[model samples]
Target: MKICVFGNSHTACLIEAWRAVRLGGEMDFFVQAGTGPAGMQLADGRIEPESARHRAFLERLGLPVRLDLTHYDALAVVGCGISKFRLTDVLNCCHVLGWPCPNPSDLPVITEPCLRAALSDALAGTTGASLVRRLRAARADVPVFAIPQPAPSERLLKMRCTGGGFRRLIRQGLALHAAEVFRQVARAVCSAEGAVFLPQPDATMTHGILTTGSFSTAATRLVDLKTPHPDQDILHANGAYGAVVLEALQAALRQGGKPCIPR
Candidate 1:
């Protein structure tokens, strides 16, 4: 089936996998750099990229700036700031009911309901969320899959991005709890707007919220796949991880086998 995938640099990993093991039908990828989903819109039910200052990126990659959505059977959005990592700020320094994080900081205790609302609000303002809104407004009749950014690499445990807050969550046996909560909120937000939220595949995760080191090692950049991601970089995953996600997406889209994105 034909599919269109849109996102920021994270689309690179999927591109790399697509090149290595091409899908049978067709898939087009449109990538805008960085985390923000600026310069684009669902104009007249078409994927328009005119205002995007980085349309050059798409042009350079030979991807289309303007697309007719009717040509595709499905749409996939990858990594435009819809991520569990967004919850790190709260998971690191705050305490919510049922977490039992001892001295989680001198901060005020927050109930789970409050945390859900906070997560929902935070995700609603993201680029991914905005795109979903546009799709809903346009009433685009197609299967929409929204994929979040891959978890940080386990190797980055000592890095500031994967700071003591996350470490505490892990040590306190709350890693899965935090990850599941984020997933539920994200899924709910996307579903409310007629989209499917696909969290990171299980095969690529460690410690619940962290990516397996194998998926981060030698990961390539989106625009220039030949160029390797910095050794210390942990934010992105490799083509292997991308391939796994694609398989999951295909399963869910086909509704034929064990789908990764649950009902």
Candidate 2:
């Protein structure tokens, strides 16, 4: 089967996780766009990769701008942090995060609407909503899925987007809300397309929560000291998150009679 994934850094981690699963079936093709873990810099100087300016910037960076969906049977759009902006006449940081303007000292506020719009726009543009409409008109069949971001944990929120102090604060405040928004988007997309949404597994073991005994001292040192691709390594799956996603995908494919690796 062929699958195309679109989205930001977290999508890269998703790809790596799928690679680890070694699904045993051939992947006809896999195309990914935008920053995946390493982050991206857009020509318009925006910090986020999902923006239109960032997409154009990637084209200038020599990445393929458009995907040919004709060859793929399924497309998955990985969830990423979506910035929220108010409908006010003037767009500003407060508007983006929904924080009160008079008391600029308070923590940033986040709402569901902003996150929904961001996810919708990203999927619609990348997955070809109009193209899908045309395909349906022509009697062609395809599947599209939106993989929602995992439920936001305070631990994860503290570590996200830490480069800038203000940005980090804003992200931390909005993290859970953003995840919820993605969840809504996943539901909406799946309902519209008869597709599936795979939630992360429920395993409690994560890389950061590993015990020293789980890895040899030497291996742990290598990881701690930043040996090759330490950031890409997964020591364990937290709360069976990986397993749950794999199971959901397998079930979805089974309904289609598609071959997949036995879990």
Candidate 3:
């Protein structure tokens, strides 16, 4: 299979993981990445990469100068600005109920709410979803999959020393509920547009919303060789996490159905 992937910063991890594992003996992959929707557009029934930065990145990767979605067997779009607000909102609301309460048993049960805005904003015609729709329009027979960025890193919950108290405030059940809500929203929106939404793999998650330590260790940027500063922690993942994502995509391809979310 030959798949072309377009994404933001998270694209590096996926590309690296796919290369590292050498997935499927006959599989081939190309990646085009940028910080956001800088130079992408849906025009005349096709998605085009117009940003110099995107082009340069592709050049560095030794990919062709022009990449047309119709030329590939499938398209995978990941990390198209699905913000962390949904998870943050849940944490903020939990705080009001004395989250770090003196008694864990007495803490209020938190019910997760659907943050439709996250998906609505991400799937707007001019945003990430546009690429998916344009591809489908260009080649109705091709498969398009929208992979959510990896979950937040477990390091997020360990910021207790910095006065964040995230460790004390984040409860497993509440975190898991928030994840389910986001997954449901992504599935509904992407599926309606004839795109499959692939949730993060089960092995990578910890505390429901955060990726495990091994997968979250390194954040690969376009130029940098080192992991990002602590401030940019969960925004990126190591190649190991990327391997998991590739595995999930293979499973989806083989099963030929909506991808499953690991609880």
Candidate 4:
């Protein structure tokens, strides 16, 4: 299968996973990395790689900006508007534990509707959804899949991105519960936009929110290859996580056959 994935840094881990599964021959992947929504756009009725760096990366991958999508078997749109750490202090401080619990010992709760509303508000103008819309407009018949960026690993509390206050509450298993709510909301967002949303594989998750230790290390792609261990990379998942995603994608493709996108 020839698959083209358009994403940000998270694409690195996915590629690593592809290699880990030894799907090199069975699946050929072309990937383009972009900063955010700035990477892709629809111009003059044609899909184009917007960022110069992204375009160059595609070229390095032997996929040019004007490359034909029809030649590929499937398109996997990853990590565009998706936030790798949804509950990070900067993003969801207001709704971190589903409610503002000043104390970690205080259990916070959120209703489904409330959680969905929050997610919708957070992901209102996601680049992934817009990209999918443009792709579907150009090729409605093509199978397109949108996978959100992986959730933060359990080491999230140690990462500088996480606030000390939120970190304490997350350990109480609030992060896992919040992740389930976020996943549901994310699916609803994808469904509303006519894109097939694939959640992170269950096996890669240890406590639902936290990533498993085997796949917990951040992708070396983000750092110099010489760095033996990442001192602060609680975001990206290792190849093991990617393997699970690939397996899940294959299963999903098989389940839907050729008609994968929900209209």
Candidate 5:
């Protein structure tokens, strides 16, 4: 089956893994790194580069100038400002009733309904969500998948910013509860747009949040494959992790499984 994927720098790992596995004709990719959501939309059922940089990057990666979803059996939107980790940022400020708040007594509590509504609202505006909606609109027959950027590496436990959520949630017990809710919300949102939300592989994470060092070490930038992600870089995964993701995606396609969080 042919698959077309669009993502940002985190996609570099997938590219490297694809090269390693030699999926010569089965895969195609477009990498556009950054937060701006200016240029990615369908025109006459085709998606082309939004900028010269995007075009150059696609050229260097050897992808077609125009992406027509009809040609591929599956399409995926990965990373590029999409992730379950976004929940942590929310947790840091305010948390839902069952969430593990750092200062539970001090921080105000929100109902699960409130959290879900907020997530739905946020998902509606995301570029990833927009792309998925358009991809499905352009080709209803093709299956679409939305994979969030992986959680931070457990090695990041060294830093307060990255590890604080994991530490706090794990300490409070029922850590997986919030994660499961996030998975459900993501799935519901993506499903609404005719895409399936694929959670990160269970083996890649620790304590339901931080990724293991094995999957995260030696990550490279999509812009420059030579430059390694800095030691403190916790978001990106390596080629091995990419391989696992590819495998998981394939299996998910085959099984057509529900988006349930792995315990």
Candidate 6:
């Protein structure tokens, strides 16, 4: 089977997890941008077309210029940001980490409609709408699956309280919040079309570990802190989480549906 995952770093994590569980070369994988360490690169070394850091990191990963998805059997769309959906208001106010409010005061002033408009504009001419269209066109034949983003790590949440003490705090928070929003959007999109929405595993244990300060050991054991994208601590999937997602996908497939991929 071949799978094409379009999104950001979270998508990459899912691909990695899928690879770990795949045996005997039965499956092929492809990934696109969403958020985090993995993604496509531009001429200047950016992962996407926008950011310098992302470009540099893309160069570091050595990703290919284009991925041919014609032979894939599944397409797993990972979570994006709240802003990505234009729901900045909900995020600015209720987000546990003070999202959409890089400066806490910005929260009180940003209006919901304005946020919506901003998101709409940001998504304009992007691959998102095209992806939706492609899914609609292919739904009758291909099995399209949506994977919800996992909950944020406790350390990440705590880091938020530091008032951006960490250099990339705001960026990380935005990415996490976006992933949450993307999960909701993906589910809605799938449900409307009778496609499968794989339920994300309950992240209480991961959260609990963060709240109780067990992250040090967990990070050392489960994460590669020495990697270039060290900021991805929150995005990386451990062996356990990866296993859960894989099992869920397998279950979904067992119901007699083919994997979601392009023709």
Model 2 regions more than 4 Å off: 1-21, 32-73, 79-139, 148-178, 189-195, 202-244, 255-263
Top-lDDT structure, candidate number: 1
Instruction: Write one digit per residue (lDDT tens) for candidate 5, span 1-263.
Output: 78888877778888788888965358888667774223765677787887777777777766666777678878888885667656666766666675444464576778888877777767656778877777777777777888888888878667776557667776777458777867888888888887888888898888776688999999987766657888889888999999889888888777864332212
* Predicted candidate 4 versus true structure: per-residue lDDT over 91-209, tens digit per residue: 24343333444543433455556556766766646777776666666565657778887776767655664545346446555666667766777777766666677888877876556
lDDT of each: 0.78, 0.38, 0.62, 0.62, 0.75, 0.44
Stretches of candidate 4 above 4 Å error?
A: 20-34, 41-47, 61-65, 87-92, 95-112, 158-169, 222-229, 257-263
Candidate 5 regions with alpha-carbon error over 4 angstroms? 23-25, 36-38, 98-105, 256-263
Prediction-by-prediction clash tally: 0, 12, 0, 0, 0, 20
Best by TM-score: 1
lDDT of 1: 0.78
lDDT of 1 by residue, 1-263 (tens): 88888888787888888888986778988778787455576667787774645677677777777887778877888889888767877655567866666762577778899888888888887888777666555545677888998877888677764456566677788889889998999989888767888888888999987889988788888766678888888778889988988888887778832212322
Question: After TM-score superposition, what is the CA distance of residue 109 in candidate 4 from its true location, in Å?
Answer: 11
lDDT of 6: 0.44
TM-score of 1: 0.91
By lDDT, the candidates rank as: 1, 5, 4, 3, 6, 2
Q: Put down candidate 6 lDDT per residue, 191-259, tens digits, no spaces.
A: 544445665654423321221123221322112222323544554444446556666766666686563
Model 1 poorest 10 in a row by lDDT:
254-263
Candidate 6: misplaced stretches above 4 Å?
23-25, 33-70, 82-91, 94-130, 138-140, 160-186, 193-195, 203-235, 258-263
Candidates 1 and 2 compared: the better one by TM-score is 1
**Segments of candidate 1 deviating more than 4 angstroms:** 51-53, 160-162, 256-263
Q: Give residue 104's error in model 6 in angstroms.
A: 14
Give lDDT: candidate 1, residue 240.
Answer: 90
What TM-score would every model get versus the actual structure?
A: 0.91, 0.43, 0.75, 0.78, 0.89, 0.52
